[model samples]
Target: MSQFDRQSFSLTGKVALITGGASGLGQNYAVALSLYGADVFVVSRTQKGWAETRQRVEENGQRIGFLEQDITAPDCAAAIVQHVIDHFGHLDILVNNAGMQLRNDVLDYQDADWRRVIDLNLNALYYLSHEAAMVMAAQGHGKIINIGSMQSYRAGKNIFPYTASKHAVWGLTKAYADALAPDNIQVNGIAPGYISTDMTRSLQEDPVRGPEIKAHIPSGDWGVPEQLMGPVVFLASQAADYVTGVMLPVDGGYLLR
Candidate 1:
């Protein structure tokens, strides 16, 4: 028998909850966990476009479920967490991947816009985490994976709110990790860099900025949603029980520049 203990990375009996999982990185994360043997439940603002996620998970022989809710709405945290428990029997992992980037120059940035980004990216994420932590604490083990951004480290122009929220995400990872250590609850984050998603399609199509962004990354190309699969699975599995408070980058070495 192999001594690698590959089972440590398997989530065969786990149940994971992902936010904004109907599309983008969240969608891929949900699918990744399912493929790795975890039943997944997704929460999104809409029910549209969920067919692919459902089909993919079922095809992989894993169960999949979802809920339509705005994460920022009052009392949503407890409701979603309860929904996961009701459907999956228990929640082993929670992925806070629902976020938005409303870009505008400093002088042109609206107060409303700033609040909008923070509500979904930071405030909502924290509340959901709070609820999830309680369940995990009671169970004596769990994982919370927050999705941060390159802005978590280097603040780029035109996305001030997004940058600030991401920085706070890293801090929350450390804070929650420290507090939840006694309960065996691991809280961590993944910071993606220059991923090629619909949101970034415009940037990729830009003649000047496209090449400029690629030059800054050591990997020499934009990353994809699938690139984050392994890192997320590792963090959510038994393999990372001893690991917490880290923001692992799925970036193509974008921070090296």
Candidate 2:
């Protein structure tokens, strides 16, 4: 490959931080970045499943660390960022992948439920990004990858808070990208579509809505968590240095139909 090509893709010696790294999409992202040579720092609410993720990352010969904490807490963002700096000394990438969703009709949505979803999905993400951005600005370069969802652009039933949070996330991504560009910090988002993860198991298995959802996807099937690996890895690497504020959908063309 050419010099530019190599520079764009390689993440050797870089340090990355991923929220929600214990399981699901977060775990996959941690491993994928490790495969590209980034040392990974993972934050999750529980230590469960972290051992497997750590093993997968170390198998690629990259350093990995994990911290168990509730990201929804007000002080969690600062703590997580400090922990990364303490352990790795520097950070090159931060993936805001920790999120929560509540399925309830708008009329039935309780204030507490709405707060719970927004607290993590949007609030925590913003706090974490803010802290990471400060460090990245000081370092003169960094990547911030937020985990948006298809709900970011379109509407879905019984997911009011989640939709609101995701839509806000895209806005935050753009706002941060614009604000941080001068500091060489890039902020972007990934909107995954109909991925086969535990979070979507209930919807995907719904006899009434499942087939309708599959038919809407041009690929005629649901995507697996692994399908997100490439898009995320690219966004987190030097390949996306010039790409910011955009929400790239890894959605099997779901938006087309």
Candidate 3:
């Protein structure tokens, strides 16, 4: 192969499972991976909105599957993993991107809310990664990309549980990387800054807070979900064979300023 062919980051013949793949960042990750030639399986609670994502992936001539899964359930991870294995016969990449955020101060936060946030953001990721790692270890190669957040390191107002869970995600990424690196499995994180997704649509529409956020970001523009595709595909491809346990900021330099 020539240098150009050798350096291509195509995921041809790989299988990827993305949680929360019906919308937002997860949808973008699924599409990007499929476009690069991977067969993608998208898992989410609702299948109502995935037509666009499915069409896009199929248009790329890649195999696509969707699973309606409430990942908050304790057994959800293992089931999803088994389903993928049964359908695709093997797994090569896992994207833990299913999460939700609610605005509530520490004092007013409810215990149930805390548990819900942690369960989906942290616990579900643990279960899914644990199951996926077993498959990867046996196969001797895989990539686990955990979706972290800017709050993984920094904090904002009124969202204590989300901040805490995101911090835990950072620690989990490193722990998994350390444990799986010897098995030829690379575990990493992508901490995105304020991206333009439905989740952040309300904030983006706010005239007051939106401008304030835009001013702080060096790029002066909120990143789109598509902007995240390149980094994710790189991390999942051969280009990142030696890169693991690092939190890559696809934030348009927001972390710097």
Report the C-alpha lDDT of model 3 over 1-257, residue by residue, as the tens digit.
Answer: 23445556989999999999878788889889998899999899999668998898999899988899899886878899999998899999999999988778668888888888889999999999999999999999999999999999897668887898999999999999999999999999999989987778899999999998898899889999889999999999988888999999888788887
Number of the top candidate by lDDT? 1
Q: Return the TM-score for candidate 3, rounded to 2 decimals.
A: 0.96
Cα lDDT of model 1 overall? 0.92
Local distance difference test, each candidate: 0.92, 0.91, 0.90
Candidate 2 per-residue lDDT over residues 11-96, each given as its tens digit: 89899999998798999999899998899999998898888998999999999988989988878788889999999999899999
Task: Give the clashing pairs for model 1.
Answer: none
TM-score of each: 0.97, 0.97, 0.96
Using lDDT as the measure, name the better of candidate 1 and candidate 3: 1
Clash pairs for candidate 3: none
Candidate 1 residue lDDT tens string, 1-257: 13349798889999999999878888899989998899999999998669988998899899999999999998789999999999989999999999999989889999999999999999999999999999999999999999999999987789999999999999999999999999999999999989998989999999999999999999889998889999999999888888999999888898887
